[model samples]
Target: MWGRVRKSWSTVRDAFRTERDTGRQARSHNLFEAAAAYVSACAEDDQERIEEAAGWVSPEALSFGVNELACRAVIALARERDESPRAVARDLLGLPAA
Candidate 1:
């Protein structure tokens, strides 16, 4: 009887684990989709929309930290452009840089 109970509990535990992992993966995928959409939308527009993108971002997934870092990365990639933070911050927000 004890052996049967243990097996049942083990099965339940594995099911719960699988459910949790699935939820996490789904959430990650959704976030990636949203971020990609945001980038695409922003890129299609002109520099005038840069400031607007800062609010379009999902603060929960990509915090201000990630945004700032990504901005710096862009600056690095544009080694010859000598872009300014304020000028590029809007594009860094996900919009196309001016």
Candidate 2:
């Protein structure tokens, strides 16, 4: 009797797990893709794309992804321009050099 109960519980758990996985697979884009879309949208100044990207993920996750992208971009720009990341960022923003 105990063995039967344990087997039934395992079957139920596996069924729920499969359902959750299927739902995840149905999502149009994952967090990383959303982040990339957000960065591209920002670079292009496309409000529509930005809004669409934001809707793809939780706000906190989106924010983290965007922050990571910005950090990488600043580092790349600084390397390309042979300047500090702060300087590169300021230059890009048309700010007076610090």
Candidate 3:
């Protein structure tokens, strides 16, 4: 799963680079927009949308945005369930409790 993620990220990076080289206007999408679209696309398994969202920002920027989104999501879930963030994250991933 992670390997596929890396591959897709790299593909986006390459496409962005090509677009830059072509002197095209950069997308106006903010980090949050890219994050939301990317995550939703991933949830729906929409590769086209994922690539489109990825193009909205640099790979590193997109990564940071995604990380922020995940953190916020975990915090929200923890609050809703009255559980610790760590516990919620572990449960989300189906990991054994420590």
Candidate 4:
């Protein structure tokens, strides 16, 4: 009987752990989505959308997301243009060409 009770408790504990991990993953995904929204707003030059996205996630998370998006964009543009990522980034920022 004690063995059965122990097994049941173990099952419940495993379920709770899974649920906790799932919740954490969902929250991280939601933050990333918010960051994507912020990046999209920046591309569109829409201040309203940017502000809305800022409200959805913490500033640090949003900043990290924005940086990640910028790096991805630079890499994609570099590949498409057959140029270095540095050149692509500099051009996007209107910096002097190297």
Candidate 5:
């Protein structure tokens, strides 16, 4: 799973480099937009969309955005399930409760 994410990040970085060399303007997507699209594309196993979304922001920015998304998701799920954020995250990963 991590390998796939790293490979995608590398691909995005290379694409961004090439675009920068060509003096092309970056896409209008902000960090949140890029994160949402990237995650949705990954969930759907859509490589093209993943690449496109990944190109919208720097890898670091995308990483931060994804982390933010994850935190928000966990909080929302915890609230809905009446559980702590840690419990919700562990449950999502199939870990036994503490």
Candidate 6:
């Protein structure tokens, strides 16, 4: 399901963000995290907004976008599901989806 993709991307994005901005040393990896974030966010949002923004990012371009979007998507989904964001992320990430 979309949840897996969203979860994986969110994890990657968060990792990258922590490395890049949370006083770590993984700057190079941050770009990938940002890209994954973008994919997840774009997929979870309202269709109208996605459509409007779609034109701005080609599939190729999205590959290079920031993973922050994925972080955003998982957050949104967690809110919609009314459950623990970490639990949902773990489920989607294939960490025992209980």
Q: Report the lDDT tens digits of candidate 3 across residue range 3-91.
A: 99999999876533433223776536677788999999999999999998888778877888899999999999999999999999999
**Cα error of candidate 1 at position 81, Å:** 3.1
As for candidate 2, its clashing pairs are none
The sequence of per-residue lDDT tens digits that candidate 5 reaches over residues 15-88 is 43333223676436678888999999999999999998888778888888899999999999999999999999
Residue 98 local lDDT, model 4: 88
Clash count for each candidate, listed in order shown: 0, 0, 0, 0, 0, 9
Q: What range of 10 consecutive residues in model 4 has the weakest lDDT sum?
A: 14-23
RMSD of 2: 8.5
The residue-by-residue lDDT of candidate 4 on 47-88, one tens digit each, is: 998987776656666677678877888999999999999999
Model 6 lDDT, residue 34, Cα: 42
| RMSD, every candidate, angstroms | 12.1, 8.5, 9.5, 9.7, 9.4, 14.9
Q: What is the C-alpha lDDT of each candidate?
A: 0.50, 0.77, 0.85, 0.74, 0.85, 0.58
TM-score, per-candidate, Cα-based: 0.28, 0.65, 0.73, 0.64, 0.73, 0.35
Looking at model 5, which ten-residue stretch has the lowest summed lDDT? 14-23
* Number of clashes found in candidate 5: 0
Candidate 3 global CA lDDT score: 0.85
RMSD in Å for candidate 3, one decimal?
A: 9.5
Give candidate 5 misplaced runs (Cα > 4 Å).
1-27
List ranges where model 6 is wrong by over 4 Å.
1-65
